[model samples]
Target: MHRFFISPQNIKENTVCIDQEEARHIEKVLRLTTGDIVVCFDGTGREYQVRLEGRENGILTGEIIHTGLRESEPALKLYLAQGIAKGEKMDTIIQKSVEIGVTAIYPVSCERSVVRLAGDKTEKKVHRWQTIAREACKQCRRNLIPEVMPVMNFTSLLEKIGDKPAIMLYENEDTNSLKALLQGEQFTGAKEIFILIGPEGGFSDSEVLAASRQGIVTASLGPRILRTETAGLVAASIILYEYGDLG
Candidate 1:
């Protein structure tokens, strides 16, 4: 069945409204007729099995057949704090990370970050990435859409991390592997987990020290260094697997 993310307000007692781009997709592209079944979610961890009632005006409407909690969400709340990369790297990272079950994404501006977005441009970029995350959620059957936060400064990012159990992926780090860090520590009942990755030029020595001082563990993917885009996905996958969410 086709799945879509709609607003909670659009959902009535027994009816759901699909409008805007989604309405266009259903009416013009899919050409789904009345009685055609489609799954709809409101990004609130609930999904409704609805039957198309056809388009009314510019909006497409559907009758809710059943509603239930989404099961695709992982039990762990995994957050990815990624150093903003250049070009399409950030886009790819957000999309794939959402698919891999990241709860939310924070774009950090490190000393070595190549692409620095500010003011109006940062807002626009954040909107674009959020759209990518939503699209990825639709593709991955994720009931909850992960948020792509506005670009944050490296220092500000560390401050926002608070006292959460977090780890940073540092290319220079040789000893503490990701596996060893998780295995060595007991973080049971940790509802939230933060994973940080550097940009194309990687993190500077001072940034690593700052993160380390903020109680974030610096770990390595392995001896082989992965690109900025690949590092987060790998770390998130390993974390999810370790926590019993992935195989």
Candidate 2:
């Protein structure tokens, strides 16, 4: 059965409404007719198997035959504070991060960041990244859609973490490795995590110091350096695996 995302507002009383792009995909692209069965999720950890009843005013309505909770969420709440890269890189990072079970993504604007989005452009790009996240969730069979937060500056990101356990990936950090830091006492039974990765040029010395002073631990991903897009994904996976949530 095909899977579709229905907004919670569109779902009510054993009935689901598929409107906008989803309706078009079912009607024009898939050509799924009445009585055809499909699965729909509302991004709130619930999934429904629905039988397509009919279409009215370009919206597809279905009778939900089954509803249940999905166990696709990770036990740990992993947050990614990524320095916004270029268009394709950011898109890839968001899509793959969702697949790897990242809880949320915060796009940060760093001093070294090449791509700068503001005003309507920033809003539109955030919307696009969120869409990518949703599609990735659908592809990965995840019930919860990871949120792509608005772009924040380095300073703002520090304030956002707020007493939460966090790690800032710094290339200059030679004393502490990711494995050592993760295995240490700081992360034991931590319910939430925040991992920060820099942009193409990486973070400046000042920015790293600022983050460290805010109680974000600075750690290195071995000796080899990865690109902006690759760093966050690798760190997120490692963190999930360390928590026994991934293989």
Candidate 3:
């Protein structure tokens, strides 16, 4: 069944109404009509099996046949605090990260970052990335949509990281590897794990130290260095696999 994420306000009693963009897609593109069944989620860890009842004035209403909790989400809450990359690299990162089950994404502005977003431009880009995340979730069958946060500077990003278990991926680090760290410790019941990846030029020594002061452990992705976009995806996948979500 096709799945879509809708707001809770659209759902009430035994009926759910899909408006605006989703309604247009169903009526004009998919051509799904009355009696067709589709699965819809509200991003609150619940999905409803609804049967289309009618469409009028660009609004599609369906009768809720069943409602249940979503089980596909991983037990581990994975958060990605990635340095903003240039062009399509950021888009690819957000899309793939959501597919791998990241809980949320923070676009951090690092010293080496080439793309700098500010004012209205930053808001527009964030909106675009969020749309990409939503589309990716639909394609990947994810019940919850990952949030693409407003871009944050290196120092500002650190303040919000708090004391959670975090790993900052730095190429210079040779002693601690993500694999080695996970293999030795138990993270099965950990509520959240933060993964930070630098931009094209990677993080400077000073930036690494700043993150370290905030209780984030600096780690490497092994001997071979991965690109800014590839690093975070690989890290998230590895963490998910280690925690048994990939199996």
Candidate 4:
């Protein structure tokens, strides 16, 4: 069945009203009509089994047949604080991270970041990234859409994520692996996790030291260096697979 994410307001007593854009896709593109079944989620862990009622003036209405809780979301919440990369790489990272069950994403501006955004330009880019994340949630059947926060600088990110079991990926950090860290006594039943990945040039030494001082555990992703975009996604997948989700 086709899946879509809609706002809670779109859902009424026993009906779901899909607005123009999605309605057009169903009516004209998919050719789905009355009695056709589809699955819809409210992006808040609520899934509804719906049957099309009819379409009028670009609005497609459906009757909710059944509703249930979403089971696909990981038990652990994984947050990605990624340094802004060049071009479409950040887009790919956000999309894939959503597919892998990330709960939220924070686009951080680091010292080595290639892309810089400020004022109106930053707002536009954040909006674009959010759209990408929404589409990814729809495609991946995620019940909860991962939030893409407004861009933040490195220090601000650290301040916001204080005392969380945060992991900062560093190529030079050889003492600990994420897997090993998870197994240690310090980590147990940790529900909220923050994973930070640097940009194309990676984090500066001073930045790494600052993050370390804030208690963010710097870990390595094996000997081979992964690209800035690849590191976070790879680490997220491994972490989800090991501790909470990704079955």
Candidate 5:
């Protein structure tokens, strides 16, 4: 069955109003008519089975057949704090991150980051990243769309995260591996797990020191150094797999 996300307010007692772009896609693009069954998610863990009732203006009304909680969410809440990469690389990271079950994403500006955004341009970029996240959710059948936070500097990112159990991925680190770190630790109840990945130029020595001081474990992804875009996704996949979400 086809699935699309809708806001909680759009859902009535036993009906859902599909409007805006989704309505256009259903009515014009897909050409789905009355009695066509579809699935709808509210992005808050609710999924509804419905059949189209009718169309008015640009809205497609649907009669709810059944409603239930989404059972696909991972037990661990993994947040990827990705250092800003150039152009399409950043987009690819966001899309793959969502598909791999990241709970949220933070675009960070490290000392070595090549891409920079300021003022209105920053807001637009963040909005665009969010749209990418939403689209990825739709494609991957994710119950909730991972949040794409506005870009931040390394120091600012640390301050915002406070004392969360975050790990920074570095090529030089030798003492700890991701699998070893999670062996005895209980991550089931963790509200947030931050995974920091550097840009193409990687994090500076000082930035690594600051993160280490804040207790963010610096872990190695084997001996091979992955690109900025590949590091976060690789770490996230391992996290989901070790935590029992990804098979």
Candidate 6:
């Protein structure tokens, strides 16, 4: 069965109305006709198996055959505070992180960040990242779509985190490895975890120091310096494996 995304409002008592690009794909591209069985997921953790019905005004409506909750979501609510990198780096981080079960992503602007955005450009970038996150959920068979939050400065992100259990991945930090951080008592039975990863230039000394003082443990992936995109994904994967639902 083909899978499509339908908003919750489009779904009535027993019908799902699909429109826009999805409808075009189903009609012209795939040539799925009436009676075709397809799957639809609303970003709100529910999925429905729909039997195709007649179309109306270029919109595809289907009869709901079965409905259930998607259990693919990880129990841990992992949030990524990623320093905005240049161009596609931010997009890749958002897409891959969502696929790996990140609960939400915050694009932070650090002192060392290469690319900066404001006003209309910032809104546009965030919208694109959020779309990428939704597509990633579809590709990875995840029921929930993680949000790409508005871009904020380094200090603002810390204020949002507000004493929550979080970690900052610093390349200069040689003392505490990420492996040992999760094994420690601080993360035991932790339901929510936040990770901070720097941009292309990495974090400044002052940024790392402030985060550490605010109770965000500073940790490293290894000796080699990974790109900004790689660091967040690596740390997220490890955290999920240790404390979340990943193997």
Question: Which digits, one per residue and each the tens of the lDDT, describe model 1 over residues 1-247?
Answer: 8988899999989988886899888878988889999999888789899999877776789999999996998899999999999999999999999999999999999999989888999999999999999889889999889988878998898888989899989888888999888877555656789999989999999998898888898899998989898999999999999889999
Model 4 poorest ten-residue lDDT run: 181-190
lDDT for model 5, on a 0 to 1 scale? Answer: 0.88
- Winner of 1 and 2 under lDDT: 2
Residue-by-residue lDDT tens digits, candidate 2, 1-247: 7899989999889999897798888888999999999999999899999999997776779999999998988999999999989859999999999999999999999999999889999999999999999899888999899999999999999999988999998888899998889999999888999999999999998898898788889999988999999999999999999999999
Which residue runs does candidate 3 get wrong by more than 4 Å? 185-189
Q: After superposition, which runs of candidate 6 have C-alpha atoms over 4 Å from their true positions?
A: none
Please give the RMSD to the true structure for each candidate, in Å. 1.2, 1.0, 1.6, 1.3, 1.8, 1.0
Total residue pair clashes for candidate 3: 0
lDDT (C-alpha, whole model) for all candidates: 0.90, 0.92, 0.88, 0.90, 0.88, 0.90
Per-candidate TM-score against the hidden true structure: 0.96, 0.97, 0.94, 0.95, 0.93, 0.97
Q: What's the true lDDT of residue 186 in model 6?
A: 92
How many steric clashes between backbone atoms does each model show?
Answer: 0, 0, 0, 0, 0, 0
Runs off by more than 4 Å, candidate 5: 184-191
Q: Relative to the unseen true structure, what is the C-alpha lDDT of residue 233 in candidate 4, on a scale of 0 to 100? A: 90
Angstrom error at residue 57, model 5: 3.9
Highest lDDT: give the candidate number: 2
The TM-score of candidate 2 is: 0.97
What ordering of candidates by TM-score runs from best to worst? 2, 6, 1, 4, 3, 5
Cα displacement (Å) at residue 159, model 6:
0.5
User: Would you give me the overall lDDT of model 3?
Assistant: 0.88
CA shift of 226, model 4, Å: 0.1
The C-alpha stretches of model 4 lying farther than 4 A from their native spots are: none
